[model samples]
Target: MVFSCLLFGASALAAPAPWYLWRSKLDGQVFCAQTPPGVGWQRVGGPYRDARCENTGVPGK
Candidate 1:
């Protein structure tokens, strides 16, 4: 269990998780996230190759 927690934390802190264009499942709003934004979030496009995914949109990223 401890190992799993540590692994998860390491990934969370790792540089440059995949950039995702996330859309709000509830409001159709778009945003960006390193991982899928938990529940209520959906992937907008394929994995963004750069930080351009962080461009203008709803501020869920």
Candidate 2:
């Protein structure tokens, strides 16, 4: 039972969060992150699969 629980936990941690480009409303500067940076920032780009914000394709097989 403990091994099964550990497997499930590891699987959950393996999934990566989608990356997005957020544009700062105050300066129009774009930055990448898994979540919104803060107030005055809006998501302008995609839920990319890669860290460089280049993969916009659908995730999973």
Candidate 3:
């Protein structure tokens, strides 16, 4: 019984899911942010004059 309790406790303390962010390319859009166990997407910005996702907080393409 003690071992079973310990196992249950350990399982409850399991690591959490990771988090992530998604930036757009058209303009400087940033969205689609989410954490582990949860998933979602968002639009940060509008279409940029350039044909890249530059200025989206992300590095150059």
Candidate 4:
């Protein structure tokens, strides 16, 4: 639909989020990173939704 394209375009133009909230499956430790989660990591919430999620991008740390 036209609306879908518009929405996708809008999102594509937006600046990259500073961090992405992620949670560790091993210990349930929540943190933030600059990219998608690696193994053993899951997204805790949306990208750039909350500024407080920003943290070191290192995984499993």
RMSD of every candidate to native, in Å, equals: 8.0, 2.8, 11.7, 9.0
lDDT of each: 0.70, 0.82, 0.43, 0.69
Task: Supply candidate 2's per-residue lDDT for 53.
Answer: 85
Residues 1-61, candidate 3, lDDT per residue (tens digit)?
9999999999887753322444544444454333222233344443332224333332222
Full candidate order by TM-score, most accurate first: 2, 1, 4, 3
Q: By TM-score, how accurate is candidate 4?
A: 0.48
By lDDT, rank the candidates, best first.
Answer: 2, 1, 4, 3
Off by over 4 Å in 2: 1-14, 58-61
Candidate 1 residues 8-59, lDDT tens each?
9988865555567888989999876667677998887746555667444333
Deviation of model 1 at 10, angstroms: 13
Count of clashing pairs, candidate 3: 7
Model 2 pairs in collision: none
> Among these predicted structures, which one has the highest lDDT?
2
lDDT (Cα, 0-100) at 61 in candidate 3 = 25
Q: Each model's number of backbone clashes?
A: 0, 0, 7, 0
Q: Which one wins by lDDT: 1 or 3?
A: 1
How does candidate 2 fare on TM-score?
A: 0.71
- Which digits, one per residue and each the tens of the lDDT, describe model 2 over residues 1-61? 9999999998986656788989999999887788788889999988888777888843451
